[model samples]
Target: MLRHVVLFTWSDDADEERREQTLAALRRLPEEVGGMTSFAVGPDAGLREGNAHTALVADFPDVEAWRRYADDPVHLQIIADHVKPILAARSAVQYEV
Candidate 1:
């Protein structure tokens, strides 16, 4: 299995509405897009310096699955329609286990 990890930091002005929208979009991906074996998203309790405010943990069969997810039209729409507005910064890391 492979883990696709994503972290996001929101600006001070980004409010609950944005979070909710982001969550809704996030929650929809596994059902709407193919190739995602698993998915999770939530706030970070770690609070490490520069640690992302929100995190997504996804498990896919392989890197190709990851690419499918990354390129899915619905996913792309979420990035353009919602995430891009409220997202201050984001980071992603992928690895196999």
Candidate 2:
């Protein structure tokens, strides 16, 4: 399987309502798109200083599945409409699991 992890830092203007909207949209990805075996996303736990504001973890069966998820229109829309506007920085990795 392939595990995809993404960390996001939001802009200072990202308020509670916008953050919640982004989270709500992201939480719908598995249902709205295909090839995601499992998915989880949420704000950081505040356990450490300088952590990313949010994290997303998803599992897929293979590279092709991951690619489909990456290219899915719903996912793209969510990024465009919800994430990009508030995003300041992002880091991501995909690895075998």
In TM-score terms, which candidate is top?
A: 2
Q: After TM-score superposition, what is the CA distance of residue 13 in candidate 2 from its true location, in Å?
A: 0.7
How many clashes does the backbone of model 2 have?
A: 0
In model 2, how large is the Cα lDDT of residue 12? 94
Where does candidate 1 clash, by residue pair?
A: none
Task: Single out the weakest 10-residue window by summed lDDT for candidate 2.
Answer: 29-38
lDDT of the candidates, in the order given: 0.85, 0.94
Question: What CA RMSD would you report for each candidate?
Answer: 1.8, 0.7
Candidate 1 wrongly placed segments (more than 4 Å): 46-50
Candidate 2: where is the Cα deviation over 4 Å? none
The local lDDT score (0 to 100) that residue 51 gets in candidate 1 is 71
